[model samples]
Target chain A: MARNPIRDEIAIVGLGSTGFYRDSGGRSAKALACDASIRAIRDAGFEPGDIDGIVGAAEPGGPNPNEMSAALGLPQVTHFSSPMPVAVFALVDAMNAIFSGSCSTVLLYFAYTRLPWNSRSAAEDPFRRHHTLGVMPAPESVNAAAAYAAWASRYIHEYDARREDFGRVALNARAGAARNPLAVMKTPLSMEGYLQARMIREPLCLLDMDIPVDGADAFVLTRTECAREKTRNPVVVHAATTGLVGTNDEDQLPSLRRHGQHVVVESLRAKSDLWLEDMDIFFPYDGFSIITLGWIENFGWCPPGGAGRFLEEHWDPEAGCVMIDGRIPLNPHGGSLSEGATRGSGHIREAVMQLRGDAGERQVAGARNALIGCGGFFFNSQGAILRRL
Target chain B: MSEDVDDAALIERFPYVRIDHDSKHFYRGWLDERLLFNRCDACERFHHPPKPVCPSCWCASLTPTEVSGRGVIHLAMFLHQGPPAPGVDYAMAAHPVVAVELEEQEGLRFTSTVIGCPREAIRIGLPVELGWVERFGAPFPVFRPVEGS
Candidate 1:
């Protein structure tokens, strides 16, 4: 393995979320962040003074760690940073800081608000009018969100894949979202409905992409020893990592076979003692359905191009989700696709909830471990495995 | 003409893209209707979207060399809706975008729209060659289907 001495040492003692909404009723990203942060601090059985480390995701229009400390009035902080978004960067940062004793407890927060470009409501809101992308991107380039569609086309060509393969991912998420109150998209999705949705980017339709919504998710991480005192069944991070390749440029990426996700799988597999067989829940990020397929294939659940078939073979029509080997459920909390794109925070938070046996109706019976694959092919590919202590 | 173009003038030419010192040569090439990518002066390797130093050899010396811009389409997508561009009418049809793998090196590619081709005809593995279209009154590199391919 990869010398994961920090394994199982850091525990996510508390988690809080603002649920998710297509609109936050004119709430700013900072407001959403503060709501989640306060709940997480209280959930951890501590006041603001007990928090000595603050790690906030540097999401677009998000409050920075220093700003959060000022707003929440955290008495003092020894470690603080604003890591780039997609969730696991802040997660790994906070976990490492706790293990290294930079701070005993860290408030990790992710606040997401739809930018003007993506959401019409956000664009019309006068408060959000100041945010700009600076340089206007040409419609022709394969960058950011467009890259997934570009790559999905390549995937079909290389593997003879079908849109049906991608649809099942959406179908699964929608099914789960019907039961998850935190999800913004609760309408059950069918493969036919997926095909009929408006084509935002060809090969990937509106349903194939995650919905942009205003929300925040926060976590309180502390030493496992500290967590054991308050909660007997605390969720501990067994392994967490972020991965990248040198040629990460969207158009210049090597191929569909290799990219950031591949590196994350290699790193996570080495660091983790638990593998697929031991997992009770799977949370492959559905930022784009193509990403979920990448995670399924790259994680070695199936061959390079077999995620679609793997999902089909293991699909549970009764539950309307994929039940791997008639047991493990994929993204029981609906993931980013239906759960309103909390980046990967929704995935991590759901994992912790499932491990704590607090997922209510979505809870997996006797759940012990959860595996999460976050982000996508180019950059921000990350993975985490959480275990009940 | 490209050499005469200064950083400020180049920035004005390609207003849609963010250009810095390292990528200035790339946009300068666009003014003269040429496609340039950074080449490691030491290892004689090529890379695109211009980086400060050679990623292959970590060599400091590099040159923005022009290429034939001939390659096969590696990836393709159509945008039913996207940002506003002068010639692109998404309502008329879904705009097509493609990443053409340059023949100079494996896995090295440039992304742009393909011209002189119907929507249905554009596909991965189709042969394409460099073409230019004026955008904001400056040459913008694009791809067109190779004749008889």
Candidate 2:
């Protein structure tokens, strides 16, 4: 089957975020969503009533798209969907809504509270009965952190990678966060501090994982002509694709190697045509540090077994370095690990920020091109390449 | 089933592990007492929580082999919180948890509680040994540092 081109297509006219924080005061998820939506609408030269479609990124305890549509008094929303983790799937849904003529102007929004709950616990609400429980049942062995840790163990053993290599990524993120005022962890992280930090999962310290935060982000999407008229710096979506390489079953683990080899790398290489080295900036999902390592190799940035060495040699914040060759910047907005968690929406927001040139102090110089990646439940992955238009 | 024992005590001593068909294959079931893990021949890598195939090689040629129960404590943490199941208490420090990397099982790591010691004594890089607790009518491996080793 011929691949669909999501190129030079739906332009993001305006982007707004509530500036992630550990707490959202007493605001409900809907209120947070509305605040971000309002910012995005006004930024795009539109009013609340101008939006015709409502889309949400499915969060554990957040407002539904339909609920948001109703709450915002949009009269009638022609399209709605919650693509969890936001970026790619949300973009796909938004584009479909625009293309199908269901809605010309779409509001893509997401919000959540930071409750410090494990992802493996049973659903606290009745709404999640149909969806799989985020937490594992008791007396059962594995949790999400442990599952990812098991993968980290495999990566280290197979490749002889060092634990310190993972630290480098975290340190780089913290440094990036220091430059980003919106980043939650503004203090510089020393190697001594990182090494001494308590472990959350095997081979993954607390620093290695993304900190959950209560936050919301929104984006305004419209046709190219409308976007140009709406905003001064419209970031065109050059190409966007979401991939589901494996099932949620036990069989998926063994298939990860092949999936990483054939499904992820091969397909991304074909679609983007821009080598990992050619990209100017990267916002690969850092839900876990190992995931970043997995992507470094999967995206063909380096050889499969060479990610550790690449990270070790190239990750130097003091020298202003990036993972890709020739100083291609990475995660300037401190990424998920350093920035307060916007789920994966932070990646999309950062891309928009880079293109809009409003990134302020943390801006990557001459960042005309950016790449963003987001992962979902059951190993679903998505990638987007954006260019400032 | 004893009436004398309180429900908390009864549930506390009862070892439990989630053993689906997938977990059964991952932690190679051996006569309901022993557990084994498989290693992929092509990549020369050991699979933790065993698997029927090599993750790296795509080859189904995997062999189940018994690993030395001994390993280094790569990283360890005491999880104060657990799944909101019953009989869990915040007072019992040992109820938290422990994770270790097996020396023999390259890249293979497991999460288990530190038995026979206070949670405060658990430290990173402590040598630990595998111990089994019966749960759901099967023995599952967990870690405890070797005594006087």
Tens-place lDDT digits, model 1, residues A109-133? 9999999999999999998988988
lDDT of 2 by residue, A1-389 (tens): 23645566688886778877765565667788888888888888887777888889888678898888878778766777888664567887898788778888899997866653533222343332344544345532345555555457556756778877787778777877888766787777877888988765555778888877767889989877687775556788777776654333221244235442235445555666555655678877777777777777777677876777887677665554355564666777887888877767888888888777888876767778887766632455677788887
Instruction: Give each prediction's DockQ, rounded to 2 decimals.
Output: 0.94, 0.11
What tier of docking accuracy does candidate 1 attain? high
Model 2, C-alpha of B105: deviation from truth (Å): 18
Chain A TM-scores of each predicted structure, in the order given, are 0.99, 0.89
* Model 1 lDDT at residue A224: 93
lDDT of each: 0.92, 0.67
Candidate 2 lDDT for residue A324: 58
**lDDT (Cα, tens digit) per residue for candidate 2, span B1-149:** 23344445433333343444434444434333344677777777776655556766777877666667777654444444445434446446325354466777554665566666666567656788877765444455667769984
Backbone clashes, each candidate? 0, 6
Q: Model 2, residue A10: what's the lDDT?
A: 81
